[model samples]
Structures are given as C-alpha cells and as structure tokens.
Target: MIQYELQQVTQQYNGKTVLNIKKLEIESGKIYGLLGANGAGKTTLFNILSFLEAPASGQVVFAGQSVFFGRTELHKLRRRVVMVDQYPIMFTTTVFKNIEFGLKIRGMTKERRQAVIDEALDMVDLAAYRGASAAELSGGETQRLALARALALSPEVMLCDEPTANVDVENQAVIRALLTRVNLETRCTILFTSHDRLQAAGLADETVVLEKGELVDTSYENIFSCSLESKGKGQKICLLQQKIPFSLPGFVPEAEGRDYRVYLNPDKIKLVQGGQQVQQRRGVLFGTINLMMAEGEKVRLIVNAGVMVTVLLPVDEYAQLRLAIGDAVTLKLKPDAVEWL
Candidate 1:
C-alpha cells in the first residue's frame, strides 16, 4: 500500500552532474538496495528523497499526494521518513534524550515518549547504554545510536546510507541481520547501498546497479543468472549462434531435457593437430608455445596472448610431438569441450 515515485530526477554539483535517476518507484515493505562503487551517487539520491535538496526539475509522488521542494510540506513529510547516516550526530546530550528528540518535537506525552525510547534502545541492543553520554561512545556504538534514534521515530520509510561501512566484519554481519529483522518486524520499506557481493546477493530481493550514474543492469534474477553462467565458462569457447540466442541462449531443453548434460567440462578437451583444413566439429588456433611445464602426464602451456591453460596427454604423445619451448603449435577445441559455469 506504500508508493514512492520519481520521474527524471537530476542533480548538478561543481559544474558536473552527480545524480540522474529516471523513473524510480518503491513499494512499502521491501528492502531494495542501491549498490555500486564509490562515487555512484547513492548519497545524492538519498538527499533527493529526503528533500534536503530538490532535483533540477521533476515530479514526485509519495503515498498518494504530490510533493514539492517547499520547506513546510517537506517538513511534514520528513516526520514519516527517517535517514540514518553513516555517522551518528552528537549533541553533547545523554543518549536517552537523543532517542526521544523526535517525539518531543511532535509534542507527544512524556510517558509515551519514554516508552518509545525504551523500545528503540532495546531493539538496537543499546538499552543498557541509554544513560551513557553520546559524545563518549565508540564508532560502532555511535552508528547503533543513529539507527536507534531513527527507529524511535517509527518512520514509514527508512534510508540507511552505508550504516555498516565503518564497523568491523563481524559487526557488519550483525548490522545486516538487524536491518533484515527490522524490515520483517516493522514492514518499513528499506533501501541500502553495499559493496559486499555476498551481502547484496543474500539480503536484497531487488538490486539496482548504477555505473557512474547510469544503470548497467536492473533485474534481480536474470542478472545473477547471467553471472552464474558467465564465470569460468568464458575461457575462449565459441557459441554456435544458431542453436542459442534465438530461444533460450545456451539452454536446450528440447534436445535432451534431463537425460543429457548441456554443459561440457573444458578440462577434458584433448588437442590433436592433423587435418590441413579443420573440420566443422573441431576448433583450431595456431599460437607459439612460450613455455611448457610437465605435470605428470599432463602439460601446462602459455600461448595466444599469454593465456594459462592445461592439456592432458600421454607421455608417449609428448615424446612423439617433441614439443619444446618457443615451438609453434596449434590448439583445438569444440563447442562441447567447455562446461557451463
């Protein structure tokens, strides 16, 4: 029932454009990640959503009403959305008061505010530190304070900008688990950016990849499906172009379905140069062997742009060919030679 929509949002900084998001939408109760390298404009998009600054010009609709850059309307909207930044804000006040600041501003009763404060601190495992001074807490403790402060407000939408970046690896896992638990318990729409591949793969149900302010890929299942098939299989094998790319792209369910294996293992391929003109079933590439090392009966060679590859042949075959260093040799492979990664 939650909806946040934007169309053609752009931002400029230092004579250079930093953020350019076109037609983005988020539904409530889902954790969508904004994943990319450094300087990928993740922070800039967060600013746009918070109304700290508006786009050059675009349209935004939150919940059901249209939104503008005016301070009054933005202030009202800000109450429902909270931003927990990378670092916690220090006020030279007690942690208990910091968590209660939002509700106090809205003129809530003291009894209700105290209850909310206790709940927030308990959720972030900072209930014991509720009486501690905000200025004296460590880095990890400060981040939890920021998150607890936001959770105290009970915002409808929460945006965490690299909340675990400064924490240790073990603490990073704990933080991720906390975020996941928060999303499930509260059902608040969540969007976070992370450089951890495994974290993004495991945590986010939707992935939005940005390359220098441009989207390289957007689909969740298909993109990882591509990566699963691309790794370890692109070691120099040719596609038929006829069989795949027309229907399922390397997937041939009709040919064998379950009985036969569609992927071939590259390590099993054996090279033998014989025909003056190569046949259609065989592959041939001529390259000089820069170096050769023996591994029992198998041999490893560097050739064709210094590609390291292995070939297994009998010692008799090696002695017969008399293959040596700097010797010109032709390599052969077939479509069935390589296994799908």
Candidate 2:
C-alpha cells in the first residue's frame, strides 16, 4: 500500500521557488533516505511530508485519502506521524517527563504512559537514564531520547531530519541499528534525510537524490559543478569548481563555457594499482585516501585530491592494494564517467 503520494508538489519561500517535485510516491512500511546537499530542499520536503507545512500548489495524498491542507483534521493525522529534527529540542526536565509529555497530550493514562515510556527507553537503551536530566545528556543520548519519545506515540510514519548528523561514531551506529530494529519490529514507514550518500545507501531500502529542489536519477556521490573551457583540437577541459581540470572529449557547441552539474559515478572511477608510478594523465587525479568503509563485498573510499571524490572497489581488489587512510593514490576517470546531471 502507498503511505503517501505527492503530486506536482512545489514549495516556495519569500517568492523564491525552493522545492519543485513533480511526483513522488512513498510506500508503506519501508525506509527511504532523502539524499541531498544543504539547501537542496530536503528539510522543506520533510516539512511537507510531515504535514507541518502544506505545499504552495500540489496535492498530498495520505493513506489513500486526499489531504486538504487546512480542511483536513490535521491534528489526528499528525498523531500518526512524527518528525524528529537534527538537533532535537529538549525540555528542561527529567527524561521520563520528556517522553511522558507527548503521551499526556494524547490523553494516555499515567500507568499506560509509564509502561510505554519504559518500553521506549529500553528500545533506545536509555532505560537507566529515565530519571536523568534531559539537558545533560550527550549528543547521541539526546538523539536516542528524542527517538524514544517519538516511539512512545507509535507513529506509523517517522520523518527524521539528519538523524545521526550530530552524534558521535559510536552513537551513529547505535542510531542506525535502532532505526533498523524499529522498522523491522513495527514495520513503520521511515523517511530520513542525510548528506552522506554512503550512510544512506547502507540504511535505506531506497535512496533518492535531490539536487537544486529537483530529483536526480542517482544515489552515488561526486556531484560537482564544472565549467567547460575550450582546450582546442575538438577537446575541452572540465574545470571542477574552476580549479581541478579534467579533460573531456569532443565538446558540444552548446556546452562551451557553460557551468553545469556533472556526476562522477563511484563505480565508474578506476583506481590505479599500488605499485604503479603516478603519471600525469589527462583524466588522472592524485589524492590521499581520507576515508574507507566496507559496503558488503565492496570497499568505499573517499579520496582527497583538490576535491573529495568517492570511489568504490571490489573487496578483493581493495585487499590487494593494502591501502591505508593516509595512502596516496591515483584515480582515472573515463570520459564516459562524467555524466551530465
């Protein structure tokens, strides 16, 4: 079943168009990751999905029913869905009271609320901190507390805006596991926004990319703005951020000197062998490996050359390279790898 369907949704702020999604369908009981950069309308779409703000011009269908922005009984609908912000605001009170507040508003009895609170806290591994001060919890603990509070309501749909953005690495793993547990146990529909593409790919059932308020057909990273400069001889130079230049084959007449978005697919990028001498090639980028993560049978790496670029290699090949975090490596990008977004 489709949990939510958005048709021709467009949101604006101060007379400027911020979000313009034509059609989006969110199915029931699946986790979705909304991937985008800052100001890419991720939060704006979250607001609309949470029904906190209606679109300027569009239709939002919830659970097979058309939602009339102001006419619908939003209070009842809001109870079935919850939005957790990146940095959750906490009440200057005990953790128990913080979770209890929402339950109280819903007219849950004290005994019932306590039971729900205990279950929520246990789910988030915060049962021991029930009496702890909400303001004094660490970043990860606070985020988990917010999740616990949201869980207390048993919302069918949960919208998390940068759920692990502010947390430490340990907490990031904990939150990710907790979300997976919640989805499996309760089968609640989950939608979260993250700037980290790898993190989204690891967690979400489906990943959606939004660029400049429009959906892009990509989930991998390395989206950059580059300008085409004439290099003569039927070739051109694609300057990344007007700095790092990568050679492009036979240029189009219409694209000359024009700034456009290009997506360098991670899998399409080739990594030079460890023992090979670094040579200055047309599509070669020399960079140090800054980050590495295991993604199933593949190893994902972030190379820091002039700009950070993501590269994915097979686990066997990554093991053969014996590369470390600070190891310098060369990257080769084929002309076909540079896709116009």
Candidate 1 stretches with Cα past 4 Å from truth are 218-341
Off by over 4 Å in 2: 225-245, 249-261, 270-280, 286-306, 312-330
lDDT of 2 by residue, 163-243 (tens): 999999999999999999999999999999999887898899988889889888776489888887876776667787778
Q: Whole-model Cα lDDT per candidate?
A: 0.66, 0.88
List the pairs of residues colliding in candidate 2: none
Backbone clash total for model 1 is 2
The alpha-carbon lDDT assigned to residue 164 of candidate 2 equals 98
Instruction: List per-candidate RMSD values in Å.
Output: 15.0, 3.6
Model 2 scores a C-alpha lDDT of: 0.88
Candidate 1 lDDT by residue in tens digits, 198-255: 4665577677766566554432111111112222334222322222111122333332
What is the clash count for each candidate, in the order shown?
Answer: 2, 0
